[model samples]
Target: MRYFILFLCCFFSYSLQAQAPHGAIRGIWVTAQDSVLDSKTNIQKAVENCKKAGINNIYVSTWNRGRTLYPSAIMMERFGVAIDPRFGKRDPLKELVEAAHAEKIKVHAWFEYGFASAQGDSGAYLLKKYPYYAAIGPDGKGIEKNGLTWMNAFHPLVQNFVKSLVLEVVKRYDLDGIQGDNRLTAAPSLAGYDAYTLAEYKKEHGRLAPPINHLDSNWIQWRAHRLNKFGKDLYQSVKAAKPNVLVSMAPNVYPSSLQEYLQDWPSWLREGYVDYVVVQLYSYKLDEYEKILKETIQQVGSKKGQLYAGVLIGLEDGYRAKPELLKGMLELNQKYDLPGELFFYHAALPKSGKMLKR
Candidate 1:
């Protein structure tokens, strides 16, 4: 009788452990450039694909490049462009939300470009209309990095504009959540040299000019603090608009995220600015990916329950994540007992789902 009781206890424990990952978040991001949103039919098909793959959530890119996927009065009022011309009159966000909800899958409006005004346009569309909104570099030109042009993330005008965009969506859509990735409350560390930021810095720091070296520790902290405040405000605003709308962030791994982009997500997590975070741990190697995952787990510590690992499944350049590597990463996630994972994109769902099913 004693041995039988012990076996029962062990079996239940194993059963609980096995069921954990299934209950955890299984999410995928649907981007604007992907074919999944090209038509309403595609949106329905994508949601069906998600259901078959056991995905419970979808982060649809509502904002990207210099326009919105949905028709936006704000965009039209500000830039004379209501929606991405690529889709004609189709409202991708509305269609996607409807389709996903029909399948009982949660949808989050993802602001993919964040404060980025344009990509490879020399700030043509929105920036041309409001040039002062552009984040200025040390050379007195618009801040352009990695083919993306940015707005002044520290400026109140920029903050208000982004807040308006988020609130608009929250009020209009029946969304499960709203998400901001690496670019939302983040600015290139080399930024903050813009006239507005410089003046604000001077007012706070005894009228001293910002150090020429952008990498100065104090400078970085100050910029990061401003971003933290923006994050807090954004969170509060979203909650006020709809208390149930989850505020999610998908920033890059910490310390490096702080050093490169003024994204101090650790502080955001600590202060309750985000409901959860999916730290981007994309790597091609299993060992390196595991090492990073372990380090991230340690950093989050007691807050691991509010963390989700962001996995890169594939890129547009035909770089599909190997099934073995993906299986290994999922195993690592299981070993660490992570709460969930959010795949980088939707295009690789078939491959990823096959591995997940196995």
Candidate 2:
């Protein structure tokens, strides 16, 4: 009996050790240190630093703070700094492709899909220009009413807008892939069924929406389907634009609940919209995280790119990433044979950045 137990333990241990982190996706998050097209920019320096850090991939932000970081014609129609604004004209997307290519690092554009913020006088522009796009705030009114806003993904214009925007970015940049930001997504609101969206639903289903205070399970399920369709369509749009450009997404927590919330990540994966996925595993407990991560990875399997465990800062000792947590993630990579791990943000990484070095 003792010998059998020892053999079983040894077999599992051997299996764990022999398993290598498998998949093509590996790397870290990236953001602009400053303006997107600033002339003083040293693209090579930034890429080299990432390469030195052992990061083989860099997810670069192209838009934030009501600014589109790349030279975007779609954005020119939206944010009026200057048509073909000089920095807008600079084309960081192209630069990223070239620079990262030289370093042999894959570069994916990071887009905050459902959220947009304007920190300055531009706030009014968000309100007046795109009132229909904004979400309903806590008070059941447009976020614009509360001085906060994000585009309603359920809206057709919004869908077309995101699709076209993604196409244009990829066509211009020739990037390795595209990824969505986690917090940048919507919180799943039935209220976002704005007039246009209601019209769309009505048109499709041949009926008016369920009355307020009357939650229709069928309507909710159908709405969820529409959302999943939208996500798949987004993936299709990017692939159609550039067949080789990888489509990756970072979904909100709990895939099942999120589907109703509007993300539908599981369906996206099973149906195969995303080629790679960086799940946000910022939990504090090493043991719990490991189990959750392993199950998540196992669910993803070896066919799709090995899940890029989304390791982030601020999760207790995991955030500090001292002895156990960091080491454990690395160990998880080895045990699962995952593609590798990815950090959540560029600025959040250590100065040396040696922890993730290739």
Candidate 3:
């Protein structure tokens, strides 16, 4: 029986490797901030726009700003609320999945705001229900950076709750993959001073946690390692529930991602935890963007097939790249032999729906 199970596993792995997209895995991210997801008409239009632009995959945001975009039994069970009221009973994810699948585009559930419970929204459901789970900072209060408040990434309760949220969707939805962005698996380096993490750290290391020095190399790696363990568990859990569903991550570029956000993505790839990785290489200057892309290529090395370049064609901050600039970025991706590219957003694509000429 064990040998039979091994054979099955080997066959599945081989099938995945064989089925990977031979051409670029052209993709786009649809974020909650766009609000286009609130209507079925908008979802259909969005999928059609992506199809016209040659996007083969859509990483739709499933969780954000303390609420889910889809009908979530897990959210309802935990918080007494299922979908974001703004959605008004509309399952945007389901709508997108159906539309995109009909168009032959794969859909991945993007958990954009993974551990983040709130962003300047004090009365968030998770925050109001379990305030104790919020991560504490050096100020000895719930840590809030750049208007975002994160749950204790190291707290067992937080990990279990968030994992359940992720797995819930995996079990309930026919998704092509599940994704974790920068904020999901990585926390601000200033966090983990919370009581739960400190106590847990002491138990493991036999000493109190370090003072709030964001640049503390040892301290940064320690917290990142904890998140890495979470990454491994998340990948395993998703695979266990749906062996064919891909596990993807789009983290900030390395070293900075490690020092500032405590994201150890390179290590995660080395450990074979995630099936796909898209390093966020958003730069306004083409030269700077290429430099980052070059470094990212070097970092991923032989694991090139598993990594993609996450280009920033547009941002909510009102920054949008010109068509020529976007084309240049795609050329660079092809130049480096990278598997594919994922735009930062769907709305960023030109309304004309024309594919960028290579």
Candidate 4:
């Protein structure tokens, strides 16, 4: 009887351990537009929903569209607007940090817009005030690609401005991490024709002008290197401010992330600039998701432990990932031994929650 009882206890313990999710950082992004941040009550509800869903981390958008979700002395000093006017003196980040921490959820301040200024507003308010920050294209106009207008990410002043925003959040908030998406250290591949960039290129290359072809191999490498350097600097700056806070990045998948947007995240990982990378592996198809997941695993090599898959759960256009597909993706993550996953937004948690429990 004693031996039989021991066997049963061991079997149940093994089963329970097997049922738990595979990673340390099961997370979700809470965007500024999400109603979860609309009030303290909503935030509490969101945190409870996350707890039930098995989400342990929340990436809250702090910066977007030339403004912050929290009151900012930086933006006030520069633009005279402390926070996004829509919230009216309420600091959603403060409320969210308190609410999420109460639930034992780690919060990361996400800089959603990064160096890009506006989506379709041509440079928006930031560039309207600081025209020199514009990331000029070969056409001698501000770079606009895929509806997002650019800032000169390679320029020193722009880099410092972005650094200041990140450091301010690190200093002000009691948070677990800080994050930047694809737009953070990345610029449209066609950018860098601005006068400042051109002058620097000329100075470096025996006083020669940059090639007219934006896709020139040498040009691509040079721009990617600049962005990579900025990423390292930004990572160091964040560490200097808060040694314990994780510096997370969610750049798009590699190779293309370099060839298209100049993100160079593999270098960021190899150099230890990012504590972990949540590669945006947003795919609606199961086979495609697996394909990319495999490729990502192979590319990261030994750094798999520092990787998290960023799944697309919902979109603003009312598209939700099918439950079975979400389940299959989680299974794939477990099969591949990826450390964790972060879904795109908060509203989709209930669907993922059900899938996670099952």
- Give the candidate number with the greatest TM-score: 1
For model 4, which pairs clash?
Answer: none
lDDT by residue for model 1 (1-358), tens: 9999999999977765554423478899998789998988988988988999888999999888888889999988987888888889888898889989999999999999999988886236788778788898777777887889899999899899999999999999999999999999899988998889999999999999898898899999999999999999999999999999999999999888999899989888788889888999999999999999988888877677788899999998878899888899888888888868998789888667767542
Clashing pairs in 2: 20-337, 21-337, 21-338, 22-337, 22-338, 53-357, 54-357, 54-358, 62-69
lDDT of 3 by residue, 200-260 (tens): 7788776866757756788788889999998899899989999989988999998888987
Error of 1 at 98 (Å): 1.0
Residue 195 in model 4: lDDT: 90
Q: Taking the tens digit of each residue's C-alpha lDDT, what string does model 2 give over 183-255?
A: 2333354445566666776777668654453135565566567667777888888888889888877764455
TM-score of model 1 (CA atoms): 0.93
Task: Kindly give the stretch of ten consecutive residues in candidate 2 with the minimal lDDT sum.
Answer: 16-25
- The TM-score, computed over Cα atoms with residue i paired to residue i, of candidate 4 is 0.92
* Candidate 4 residue-wise lDDT, 1-358, digit = tens: 9999999999977754453222468899988778887888998999999999888999999888778889999989999999988889899899999988988899999999998888776339899899999999899999887788889998999999999999999999998899998998899888999999999999999999999898898999999999888999999988888898899899998889987898888888789889889999999999999999999888887777788899999998888999889889999998987768899988777666767542
Candidate lDDT scores, in order, read 0.88, 0.63, 0.83, 0.88
Better of 3 and 4 by lDDT: 4
Off by over 4 Å in 4: 1-23
Regarding TM-score, does 2 or 4 come out ahead?
Answer: 4
For every model shown, the clashing-pair count is 0, 9, 0, 0
Task: List the candidates' TM-scores in order.
Answer: 0.93, 0.78, 0.91, 0.92
User: RMSD for each model, in Å, please?
Assistant: 3.6, 6.7, 5.7, 4.3
The worst-scoring run of ten residues by lDDT in candidate 1 lies at 15-24
